[model samples]
Target: MSISPIAEPFYADARPIGPDGRRIGVLLSHGFTGCPASMVPWGRHLAGLGYAVAVPRLPGHGTSWQELNKCRWADWYGEIQRAFDKLTANCDQVVVGGLSMGGGLALRLAADRGRDVAGIVLVNPAVHTERKDVLALPVLQHVIPSLPGIANDIKKPGVEEHGYDRTPLKAARSMLAGWKQVRADLPKVTSPLLMFRSAEDHVVDPSSGQIILTSVSSRDLTERILEDSFHVATLDNDAPMIFEESAEFVRRVTGP
Candidate 1:
């Protein structure tokens, strides 16, 4: 009926911090089946650097997989769009980024907003899935509520993403639908782009990143390979790399 009390402890919602003079805003989203816990560190890092930051908890996330099943990709994208609007309301510019499904949502934002979104950064963003099982989701979701989870795919041993343990088929299908929309509009994402892909991501395939790199019309594009992480690289060994480099990337794009 509600979010598990166990997950309550792991839920985090962070907002912008620092001086008003900092005119740059950063909006980040968590992966599918994931809550804000995976991105709190990154959001806090950007906030510490004086950029306004927002990491919103998507609808149906951090609550229950059954609740997530009730949510459509449009619901998730609506939350990101709201957060982005809030960020751009005050800040002179905004940079959007996310992990996994969040990344696809960010891409959608970049495509929709274009010049409004100053830049794009993604870590193991999932735009497409080659899994045959995903093909069965259309029917499986009608019969089964959930399957095995795709959350917390980290290389770090003690770290946890604090996401849903059971993957909701209906919600997964919504994500795939969102991915198709984002991919179709790839040429519309013309902002400067930076992406990091784990060498051994188990959740999103490497081809996901490839499709993005080859499709986006952004004049500036950069790709980095993470040698020491997995799909949830934000919470793993290469987290610092993402934080540091992403901070620099924001500064580079938003300017002094």
Candidate 2:
């Protein structure tokens, strides 16, 4: 008997930049259960600057919540590693960035790859939980699964006030496990990092940002607080700043 596929259909769309072929590729990873749709604009902006950009849809994303529930951190990290490898092959240098859980993955990649990665840009990375219920759980994660739900905290411009819109409990549990793993491995990240935090973020704990700054070994670390946005600062008032800062950081790291 033939076996069935384990993953859902997903895509990685690439956009090129510049005339001299001096492209600096950037790999963008989206938040948990979020598709590339959220990071498309950032990729486009980078592409406009003569850099190749790749945004990969993580495993179990852009599909039903059930698929997300079946995914683990390693699965998601594998997809990101593939995307990073592809970018490295196409460009002279590569930078990695992500939102929320994706940020955790980015940090993990930068840590593992060492100097191969040019830099990192993180927006509202979830390093620790302020949620008492989630932090209290021990073996309950393996016993019960949670459904995906709307994000209660978002400050994107002109977007409706909505939450994640789906709350896959099992997926969240797995992601939490991944976050813990990444947290343990933070000291390994040596690349220059730019961490952006939202002052009004209601979802992720504000201290998570500080933890990242203190944990990474990157001497060129820069931290910015977005006062007008929430957790999804990439699409909010701070987006332009993010775009500018990210481009600037990549330029600084890769040289003129």
Candidate 3:
């Protein structure tokens, strides 16, 4: 039997900066149920531009959604934290970024790391949901192991994200608790922020973006409305724009 796409090698190892001599580090995380494939293009773009970039696949991800249910928020957070530590240990400066649930994780990292984080970038970061079913997750998690998948919310045609097709309920509950903590500590995010909101995102609600802006204390924040893409903007129509702009953001924040 062939390995599932999610189980394939989806992570990108750190690429050393040679020609650019930027010595800037960037850590990019993928969303819930999403594998590193979603962030690979973005990370590769940065690496190609001569920045040391690592796109770490979260624990319990890129394997099976059922396995994801076995993991908690701490497991996921620890994975990214390790990646960030590796980046900052060698590079002169470091920036963190993510998409959707990964965005929340990145924000939490910024809060815990404090001034160590030079900047953050979020593409359609999701925090809270208006769905009443969310309130029932505590009970439903015991009743059901998963829900319909929310992955691959790309606007472009015939594009697949290769994430878990089923959304794990147990993992989602843990992630929700994480988002609560992140929202409470939003004021601690003092790093420069570059946020992109899709004008027509299918996965994350538009209100989620507003919640981030209203909550974060970063005065050096930049927001762009992606009119041509969806929630997975990194792989959508404006993907190149995200890649180039984020590379620029890291360069500008870290100084050449």
Candidate 1 — what's its lDDT? 0.87
Index of the highest-lDDT prediction? 1
What is the lDDT for 146 in model 2? 60
Candidate 1 local Cα displacement, residue 38, angstroms? 0.3
lDDT of 1 by residue, 147-212 (tens): 988887888999988898899988888889889989999999999999999999899988899899
Q: What is the per-residue lDDT of model 2 for residues 165-204, given as tens digits with 9 covering 90 to 100?
A: 6667767877888887788888988998988888887777
RMSD of each: 2.9, 4.2, 2.4
Model 2 misplacement above 4 A:
1-21, 136-144, 147-152, 160-164
TM-score, cand. 1 vs. native: 0.93
Q: If scored against the real structure, what TM-score would every candidate get?
A: 0.93, 0.87, 0.93
Residue pairs in clash, model 3: none
RMSD to native, candidate 3:
2.4
Give per-residue lDDT, candidate 2, residue 190: 90
Pairs clashing within candidate 1: none
